[model samples]
Structure formats: structure tokens, C-alpha cells
Target: MSDNQNLLAGQRRALILDEVRRRGGVRVSELTRMLRVSDMTVRRDLDALARQGMLEKVHGGAVPVPEGRTHEPGFEAKSALETSAKYAIARAAAGFAAPGGAVALSGGTTTYAVAQQLVEVAELTVVTNSVRVADVFHTAPRPAEGGPARPATVVLTGGVRTPSDALVGPVADAAIAALHFDVLFLGVHGLSEGAGLSTPNLAEAETNRHFIRSARRVVLVADHTKWGVTGLSSFAALEQVDVLVTDSGLEPEARRVLAERVPELIIADAEEE
Candidate 1:
């Protein structure tokens, strides 16, 4: 390419990186419109930036690299990403929730999806650290006056709230220590073979460990995008996971590897729901 073309590409990539830094992430479609370029151009820009390690390319978008090991995006920042995949994973994870059984749910956008799915389960006692997840059940419609009032009982742990809307720290850990669950639907910031399940928040990581210990079965609910991403703090290893419920977006090789690590792996079809 000529110097002029090279200059233009460099400028475009700078703008793309700026947008990602500003918004935490940007979709190719959005960038195309913002940059007044074709989708192909936007994708190429993303590919180039990803190669430079300036931003991480997700399924259809690019997110700024986490600053060191402690940087974390807020709930709203992450809520818009991987929506269909999250719902699909939620559907699969919710199947593990038995009727009238106790379940623990950790905080994250994906676990919030799982919480939405669990609202209809009868007589469920859901213990959760996510304010958002607890709201899913709290705001659910009540049964008719004459009908049996069998709404899921939600216990929101009290603690300092994190960027992802998770109640963490000492209070949250103490509450979880007294409770045990039949299953725990845990959501993580990142997962990998080396670091296992991890999060940028140190306190949240400690609280998640408590959740893991209190549950008879640990069901990890994460999308394909979390693969190979390691956070600041590691909570559980892949081998400790009783089951993994992820979306079909996971690559076949990853599926094979995860199947070997975890006892059960459930891949939900994102397009189906």
C-alpha cells in the first residue's frame, strides 16, 4: 500500500481504538457507521488492532484490553455483549436447578441471565451476591391470590457492591459460609486452562471461592468469548467444575478440551433461543 493509504489506515485504527477505549467495546457494525466505512474495512481495522494487541476482538466487536490484571468493566459496560449466547447459556444452566432445591448464583451479566431463567422454578431458595440477579426474582410476577404462592425465595447477600453489581467482601463471604446449595450457577470474567476461572476483582474472587465450597455441584455459566482470557485472580480450576454450560459459539477444539476437563459440558444453540 502507498504511504497515503497507510496513513489513512493508521488514522482509522487510531479512531477505532479510541472508540473502544471510550465505550469499553465497539461492534464492527457500529464502527462502520461511525467511521463511514464498509463492514469489511471495519473488520480489517479490528483485525489489525487485535494483531497489535491494542484491543481484543470478540465475535462481532472489539474490546479494549483490560488494563493489567485489575481492570474491570461495569455491568452496563458488559451487558450488551454476547446477549444471545448468554441467554442460551442461561437456558442450559437453569436446567440444573431442580424444583424446590436451593441454588447459589454469583454475580456477572451471564449469571444475571441465569437468574432470569430461574424465576419460574417452584419453591426455589436462591442465594445470590448479585443485586441484579436478585432483582430478577424480586421483580417477577406473583402468583394469583387464590393460587398457590410458590415464588422463588431470594436472599441477597449484603456487602460492598463491585463494578459488575456483585456484593463482595467479608459480609458476603460470611453469609455464604452458613449456607449450602444443591447447585451453584457461577459466572466468571474469564476462564482458561492455566488460570482456570478468574476475575479482576480480588474480593469478588474470594467470595466466589466461598460460593464454590458451599455448593454440592458447581455449574460454570460462561460464553465462548471467555476462553483464554485470564483475570487478576483465579477462583476455581477447570477440574473443580462439575458441569460447564456454554454457548455453541465455542470452537470444536475448545469443546473437546473442556469436555475432558469438566465432568459434563452442555453447549446451547444460540440461534435456537
Candidate 2:
């Protein structure tokens, strides 16, 4: 109401924006402490920013506006963007697989990396649409301590191919409907608190949705850059995922929101490589 009060509110909002920009996300409690503002004040500021299209407001915080989420990159291009981060996430995600159980993998560079790690798995039933991903298991042999190792069974979904090498269409969707998996690993173009799990291709989104339904437990593998981007179509929500394996490049604020919203959060540190 007063001149100084207005100035303080303006300054606090500016700081809030800066913090979210730097960390990709921010929590209300942390913002209150950092900005020395009341709970109501923080919410009001976040709401204002959200209305301005500057950020997306989540359960307890805000994430910076995801840029280029609607843009789909080719497989080769994406694989080169975050090589180290993808490897770390892949390894972490592969640990979730049950040795003899079935697993469904979506198309993406990160998921492909996960599949590569899965080549070591002696026995696994893998269902996927990516040619490269399926090849990893079929071509690579798993060494066994005794006699011959049981080969991993890879079921390829038939459908139209995209720039990212994902198979999608009525065919792919139908294949997913007929089978159930122990776990599903989904890789998306971008993740936003509001949009949930999203991708640039509509057909891929449709196909990925069935993968979510086929598996009782779903895990999302993505790098930090995927946080703010909201793809053109959303396949799953943040709460729908059973586990998330991401790289340490994620901001602390984003990490906090994930820990609060999701059941489990695993940050794959690249230093282990």
C-alpha cells in the first residue's frame, strides 16, 4: 500500500525470477527465506510471474519457462547434446530393471543409452520402437558364468518412424496394448510441472502413453535441460512416474520440487564416469 512497500514487492519479484532462472525452479519456503517475504507474498509474486508466461508454478514452487520444448531434434543431434549426463542417467535407470522381468522403453537418446547398459542383462524382455535401441540388445552378447547366457528378447513395435527414430501410430499403440511390462522407461523432449512429460511429436506421444499404461511402474530418464521445456504434447503427469533418474545438472530448486512431488528422485552424477 505504501510507496516503500510497492518498491519492496517489485524487488522481491525480480529476485524470485532471477533465482528460478538460475536454478530452473524454486520453492515457496526457500523463496520466503531468501527474499525475506511472507508466504502470501511469495505466492502472489509467483502467480503474477506465471500469468506473464515467465515461469510455470508447481505444487510448492516455480520453474523457469521451458524454451524449445516444442522443437524435436534428430537422434544424432540429441545424442550429442548431453553425452555425459545421458550415460549417467542411463546407468542409474538400468538398475531399476528386474533381471528376468519385462521392460518397455520409449524412443530417445537417453533411453537408448539405458538400453545400451541393458545389453549386459542376461535375461530381459524388452519392448521398444527404436531400431537402434532394439539392436543394442540383439547384437550384444551377455557373458554368463556358466554355460550360455540367456539372450535378451527384444520386441520391436511396427509404425511410422520419426526424426528421433521413434515408431508411432495405431500399430505401435496396438502392440503396447497387448503386453504388460514390469517397468516402463520414458524419455521425453521436455518436462514441466504443468505439462508433465511431453514430446514434440503427436504420434509419439500417443505411442508413449500406451507404454505408461502397459507398465505398472514407470521411470523417467532425462537431463536437466529437459526440465523447463514443455513439449507440444504431454503423455504423462509428474505424479504418474514411479521413479525419476536424472543427472546432477538439475538445479537444487528443481530437485526439491521433484523430491516433494515424486515418490523417488535419483540424481545420476557424471563424476562416477
Runs with alpha carbons beyond 4 Å of true place in candidate 2: 1-69, 142-150
User: lDDT per model, in order?
Assistant: 0.87, 0.84
TM-score of 2: 0.73
RMSD of each: 8.3, 13.1
Model 1, C-alpha of 273: deviation from truth (Å): 2.7
Off by over 4 Å in 1: 1-66, 146-149
Write out the backbone clash pairs for model 1: none
Q: lDDT tens digits, residues 39-157, model 2?
A: 99899989977776667899999997665746676776465456778999999999888778899899999999999887766578999988879888878855757854554588999
Tens-digit per-residue lDDT, 1-273, candidate 1: 223233477667766776787699988988777777789988987887777567899999999886667878778656656777888899888889888899999999999999888877889999999999988888888888876555457899999999889999999999999999999999999999889999999999999999999999999999898998889999999999999999887988889889899999999998986
The TM-score of candidate 1 is 0.78
